[model samples]
Target: MLSRLRRFTLCSLALVPFAGPALAGDTSAWSAREGTAARLVAGGAQEGSHDGSLIGGVEIRLPEGLKTYWRYPGDSGVPPHFDWSGSRNVEAVEVLWPAPVRFDDGGSFSIGYKRDVVLPLRITPKDRSQPVDLKLNLDFAVCGKICQPANAALDLALPPGGIGAPSAALTQALASVPRPAELGARSEPGIAAAELHHASDGATIRIATHVGNAATADLFVEGPDEDWALPLPARETGADGRTIFVLPVDGIPKGADVTTARLRFTLVDGDRAIEVDTPLSAR
Candidate 1:
């Protein structure tokens, strides 16, 4: 946990961090407010696993009927972007995404969170002995009926022996991140078995997700990196009590083969969801 300095006013935060941003830091939770409130979290110093570096969490509060985007925003949504040029003492920031649900806006499909969400970030400091002045400039879009752009310019000041406190909300959000899984690794109970077949443009992914009512379920697929924008999964069912989703992969650059490319899946069953990362291959 990194100690927070609440010395800055909202007016200052809205202006200063925009000057320059470079994020690589250590510490717990620090929050700033905008249209939707955002908090910076410094983690790992609480449980005696003080490895100098910290896993940070950005807690975003979404009002009812409002939604934010995942890294890949499916058919018709803009993804969130971060600018760390305004930060200091930071080396790198790794964005970790939680499982997302598919939302139908008219006829277009989008993937994101309808309620509050916390995005886990891995932060590495340049020096452990030194403190970090963490700043963030996040640009994102929120949609309900009309889509609007949103921004959060947050700041956290920490000195030596300073750490941020742990947050239950942030902790739970981090816990919701997708568990790692391999292709055809169905031995894990309650987990869906995923397989793939080659297609003309890319590949087709089949996921054996068990659900009582297939109509109530939703599926989201992500590509290997942020660049590979795959489409949402198409839902299907068999005579058995299981449901299968066939996703046609596309959006990769020319000459890129999706069969050998890694993929991710997020299956949403009502309020419950699970995420997995694996590769696809021809049957």
Candidate 2:
């Protein structure tokens, strides 16, 4: 009878499933580097999303006095890169950048976020019925006295039903992204005009902006392509009571037509910012 009881106990134990590590939560474990650390946070399916899109974010934490670059790191800095090939059931992932503050790097001015930042991600699932597994390999730079490259590998899984609710951090990050605007927008903190002027030395782009405070307003310009390294715009007072920003056209790519090149302008004032894309034309 004792042998029979022992055999029955063994059978019952064999039938029971083995326990493993717990499933990941909405936020992934932090992947730490030298002066920075990063993680992935799932914001679940967006409410009332038309295309079944989901919201997520890459949160980067930096020590005091350290900073990370924007999509186009001004003057001299390396931008962050993301690789999501290892993910499953993901059709596309769009990274959105928040408005960054301008800071001095050595003697040159650079644009980036200090302390911490959450880059909002808009994700589309290949199979909405199945869970989406996200695998990211993020490579970014952190600068203080000097710049250094940092890498983090992060993963998170989102079920079809979602993580119960949206993430507030992601919501704020999304709101911080520059709103799209047209050239010559009349709104405050907007681009009023942009024109190319020719001088004996070379060509320069002059832009006029409307903002509450001229001292706190700034403008950043990007060429049609990444190869066109445009300089930061310098602020000046316009004769017509608008704030003017001027930049010399010194970094045009060879063989590229300056008159037809489409330029992107990011105008920032205080806590408000706007992005405008317009063609370059001589005044």
Candidate 3:
């Protein structure tokens, strides 16, 4: 039987210390953290936009020796939680996560950020003509010697024409987002191949991508939804002369047919990362 998996939330009672715009001069910043700050930015809302979706984001500047977690916090960290209850005209919120580095958190292996980071949001509005009032109550954990829980309430009213001045922080953040992976496409920032093998326990996923430096590379995998917590990936050099990563799948419903399951992989190498969703197979 498949057990229900809820959002990975930890217990905490620390006073929210962040709640305004970040220090990088974004006016929509809402500072509400202890050692970090948070800001909300909206863009791509111009005349005759073809995508029909608005791009928004939250920028977090991590001071020296501070770090934050990704959507999946690896082994023993907290994943961020966003509450859009106060949002107006928002139909959906699709979060775009950057590649994370693997490190030890509280003596346990984990995956997260070692420096400043940005979380871009792809928002679908109910009415494109109307302005969007983006209200975000973001709860995330930042760590140094101790893990600290922080929260920030931010609101941005995105009107047409977007920000007059281009924000370097946001521009860089948008660039860092992973490009979609294409198997056998033989392109820069693309996936070479991915293979999955099923077992009695669950499954093992193997992926290979083109990378310049293997030592600085890392791969992170995510399950079908926010509730599934998967293990970290192991890196190795394939016999076929490609950078390979293997991940063991475990936390899923018992007897669930995962032969056709889909998984998302984020390959992070230095300042570049790409994302791809690969389907599982019985073979």
Candidate 4:
């Protein structure tokens, strides 16, 4: 068995040299590690398209039964951190996360991806007249029995005017990202309401959603900022054909105003999911 110390030591050696620069293809060469590998993929835009944003992706591949953490890792694990400071002809980059599945890590539940995932990127260029060069330094963790840290440096370039057809891989990845929805929207697979209930013991949040199967559904909550490490909500019995989840109002930072807090809720039911952002409110 690989001990924790040995796993980390091997992981450190894996990062000694960065992967070579991307060649002619829209996808970069895979940067392979012990149990994981990563590559950057470019989704070219249609000719003469002026959508103002270009699509790209960071693809991470994990061995079967191994996993990686999401933006919020739940009970334990490190979220992926990205650095693009080395890029040229780029103004901003936004990484969009696909819906993550729940994992039973020992007795605790963690949220992340299994097998492989392509985190789609929406990039804005400083000058549309010139090609955009993208450099990515990705830091993430992979876990099975023991979690291990991994890093990859990747590069990709997009032509001026965002020409070329979007890659099929990136198209599928972009489709997996949760679509934004409003609270109380009467849409399938949507959050109906989020109410806060206070008692002598403590406060808990109740969220109601409209999904096909309540038993297989799951909900994840995120506070306004990274400082808030909110606990994963538990599924409970619901009424009126709605799925219910309850989250204890613990993990709020000291002196933080609960009323002013904007919570982000990601509701996942099998292959369907939706993202809802709204202010906290009392029942």
| Number of the top-ranking candidate, with lDDT as the measure | 4
Off by over 4 Å in 3: 1-13, 21-26, 32-34, 44-48, 198-203
* Model 2, runs deviating above 4 Å: 1-23, 33-35
Candidate 4 deviates by what RMSD?
4.5
Local accuracy of candidate 1 as per-residue lDDT tens digits, 83-126: 87766787777787877877886676777889988898766667
List the global CA lDDT of all models: 0.64, 0.79, 0.71, 0.79
RMSD of each: 8.5, 15.4, 3.8, 4.5
- Select the stronger candidate by TM-score from 1 and 3: 3
What candidate 1 gets wrong by more than 4 Å, as runs, is 1-35, 44-51, 159-165, 187-193, 198-203, 210-217, 268-274
Return the candidate ranking by lDDT, descending: 4, 2, 3, 1
Summarize candidate 3's per-residue lDDT along 1-283 as a digit string, tens digits.
1222233234455655666542322347547344588878766652355645777688777789988888777777777889998888888888877667898765566777899887877777888777677888888887877767787878888754344533676667778878886565565455777777778986787777788678878888777875566677788998877788887766665544445667777878778888878775445
Residue pairs with backbone overlap in model 2:
none
Model 2: per-residue Cα lDDT over 1-283, one tens digit each = 0111121111111121111122378888778534478888888787788777888899998899888888877777767889999899999999988988888875777778986899988888987888888888887777777656677778888887457665787788888889999887889988878899998998899998899889888888888866777778888998888999999887777888778888899888887889999986678
TM-score, ranked from best to worst: 4, 2, 3, 1
Q: Quote each prediction's TM-score.
A: 0.76, 0.88, 0.83, 0.90
lDDT of 4 by residue, 10-69 (tens): 223333234646644677778864548888887765335465577788999889988998
In candidate 3, clashing pairs total 13
